[model samples]
Target: MTQPLPTRDTIVDFIEGIFLRRGAESYLGEAVSMAQHMLQAAACAERDGAPAAMVAAALLHDLGHYTNEMPDDVLMEGTNNYHEEAGANFLARFFPAEVVEPIRQHVATKRYLCAVDPAYFQRLSDASVYTLELQGGPMSGAEVAAFRANPYLEACVRVRHWDDEGKDPERAHPPFSHYRPLLASLVTS
Candidate 1:
């Protein structure tokens, strides 16, 4: 049986009291807020002509990090495990497969693409590079071969790109408050 959805007030309180605490300075870097980062990723996905589900996935990809404090070891290891997986797991109860799967597989996709596409890893931020090593580095030839064989490769790649682009602070996107409507819709439906 499906679990009951969280109330809109509950979600808002969580986002405010937990996720977006300190006005984005604490969670985000010198420039952007967590909300801004998420919106930028969603915009990037939209610009790249991704599907609605994928865009939503991009928008909510980091939800877990804000909602729960993840382990530093897991964050550093970069092993197909991290905030993305955590976020996906949390979202699965409320969202459909199309949304959850993309979030779940985003990190793996990033790793796979970095392994196969030489140019991909080159563009990663210094932070991402350091974390990649902990996450087990790039996939092996055998791993890449197997990963590329998956049907969701394209979506994963798009999500990964957006994931990177979302880091910039200069990008224009809606505040986290904007998603309240969408969140409410999901909860009520």
Candidate 2:
């Protein structure tokens, strides 16, 4: 049998370690840290009246960057680092469906928007564009059709919007530490 995943405290510790070692340089420029970005996004989601679960999902959406080092080629190729997959996989062990599903579906949501919404991709920053190419080029028609069929489309859209707008620290949600108590309770229970 496989070993059990780390406890929630361990996951939190892992997050702290990422904050200390990676800082923000990996995600964007040094001007804004990953932790800061996540918090800002979470805050924005919360302020916009998103449910607590979605706000939490927004805050932790990029958790994969902290847990694993994405290859630069993957970053450049525009292929999904499976960040959504990774983040969802990790969080699902501890968080409820309300939290995990949105994180899992965020990337698909982005693709769906890009495919149908004419102005959607244009708003992405240069870096985002570069990454998008590597993440598998605009969604194919089949992918779009698949996305349209999903029930989680609304949550995914909200999460994607929070994600794109979240890079700005000033406008995103509160710090990750703010969710620590809630995480701890979930893990221990």
Candidate 3:
């Protein structure tokens, strides 16, 4: 039998299991561990006054990486594990569509941004750039139009920008307990 979907409390337990055990976990190529990277992203969203659901999405955007068991060096091995898609699908079982869709499309938002803004690519971290090529380089004109048609594009972009910012190892942020209520509020069962 399949496991029951996570509730607010158990989700926190899941977070602790998947993220907290690691030591200084590197994100793709970030100096911080996976937990730190996620916390940083959620902190940015909170600082910018994002809605609670968006903040939750930021915090859990890479749930797929943990769930999929993708290695930290997946990018180095020249694979696009499509962690964004994996993450979104997994989260859908627990979150509302509003929350899941942005996680689903955040990586595509990166590609769309690169095709539209020359400077965006310059700001990408080395690991991000490496993954970009794996994600299919920049989007073409047709691809941009297709991406624009997605209703979740704005939210996805916001999460993507915060994903970029979340790489910092030294930023101050609240602990996981601070977000528990928000997760409970957003989860629909």
Candidate 4:
């Protein structure tokens, strides 16, 4: 009996709330904070001339990480919180499928990339590789084949690329307020 997030402003405020408080906190084991990572991703998407839907997805791709009260130490303790599913489910109530689907599949996109491209695995950061192992490692042949068949697979991969490259603590990017209009337009009643 889960409900989708409320109005677009509520949803946007929820995101802003997280960023205002926990934004400065370390992003799990990554160098940048959570807010920085998300901002970087969103900025990257915009720079690449992505659609508004995808830019929104990139901005909120890791919403799962904040959906619950789970301890951040869970990752250190070797736990997979499945934040992707949590985020997509929560966002589904307020956003179109285009925005939500990419968030849901970003993790799988990582595995899919790892499966199809050996070089891809080598490019991951140490923290990413660690989480990849915790996330069931690379995709198997069957998993890769199934992943390939998904229509939103490309979207997921695009977000994944931004997610991977968005971890720089020193990276310069605009503030979260820059995306407010984009997020507001996509918000449902």
Candidate 5:
């Protein structure tokens, strides 16, 4: 039989365990580990004076990477893992839409940025560039317009920017415990 799901009180710990167990893995060949990347993203959001929910979204934006079943190189092998949707779906169970919507839209924001800002595409890391092709290689005019209509567009872009900056190997980041209380405050259930 399957194990019982974690209750609201225990869900935070369950998430923490995921970090402890898997965060040390490489982040798609980036210089930082997955946990470090996430923590740095949270740090960037927090440093920029973002609201609590946006900071949380940045912290957990790539959570689908952790939760997805595929190998880390799945994107390199030319597959759109759709980790953004998976992460947002998982987070929606416990987080409010304010926190979850941005996570869901973060990937699309990448494509959107590429379409609107040529420099943005130039800034993407090699792995991100590779994944971009699999992610449909930027938005068309109609796609850009539709993305601009999203209520969470600004928040999603903020998270995406943090995601871009979070991969710096030299950046120092706080421990996950630093944000545990923030996570607890945002839990919906």
Candidate 6:
């Protein structure tokens, strides 16, 4: 049988368990561990003075990597893990649209940036470059137009930037507990 869902009061603990258990894994061949990458992304959002919900989005953006059923080598083996959708859908259970939508759209935002700015493509790490192909490469003209129309476009882009910047292995951010209150504040009952 499936496990019971976390209630509003216990959701933070449930999420914290995820980080503690799955966060130590490699972040898709990035220099940092998964937890480090996510914490660092949240740090970037916090440093940039993003709204609390955006900061939460940046923190939890890659949660699908933890929640998905795919093996670690899924991307390397030529499969699209679709982590963005998995993560956003999971977060939708407990978060507002402002928080979940950015996570959902972050991968597309990467594609959007690649289509709009050639230089952005050069900045992606090797793994990201590989995944970009799996993610449908850059946006086509119509795709770009649809992406532009998303109300969360700017937020998605900002989260993408943080996702890129968050791979620095040496950078340190506060632990998950530091953001627990912020997360709790945004959790829907």
Q: Point to the candidate with the largest TM-score.
A: 6
Candidate 6 lDDT, tens digit per residue, 1-189? 123556678878878888898899998778999999999999999999999999999999998876543233333333344778777766787899999999988989999999999999999999999999988999999999988999988898898999999999889899999999999999987
lDDT of 3 by residue, 37-57 (tens): 888999999999999888999
User: How many angstroms is residue 134 displaced in model 1 relative to the true structure, after the best TM-score fit?
Assistant: 0.7
Lowest summed lDDT window (length 10), candidate 2? 70-79
lDDT score at residue 25, model 3, on the 0-100 scale: 61
lDDT (Cα, tens digit) per residue for candidate 5, span 100-170: 99998887899999999999999999989998898889999999999999999889889999999999999
TM-score of 1: 0.75
Encode model 2's per-residue lDDT on 1-189: one tens digit a residue: 112345655866655555556655546642457777777777778779987777778877888664444323323433444777776766776777777888888766776787888799999767777777777767899999988887767777888887888676455445567777655554523
TM-score of 5: 0.90
In candidate 4, stretches whose alpha carbon ends up further than 4 angstroms from where it belongs are 1-5, 69-81
Steric collisions counted per model:
4, 15, 1, 0, 0, 0
Residue pairs with backbone overlap in model 5: none
Off by over 4 Å in 2: 1-5, 8-17, 20-23, 29-31, 69-81, 169-173, 182-189
Residues 1-189, model 1: lDDT tens digits = 112334444644454444465345433332566667777888888777877778777888777664334334333444444677766766665667777777888777878878888899889888778778877789999989898787777777888899889888677876666656655555423
lDDT (tens digit, per residue) of candidate 4 on 83-153: 88777777777889889999988888998899899998999989999999878888999999898898888
Candidate 6 TM-score, C-alpha based: 0.90
RMSD values, in order shown: 5.5, 5.4, 5.0, 4.8, 4.6, 4.5
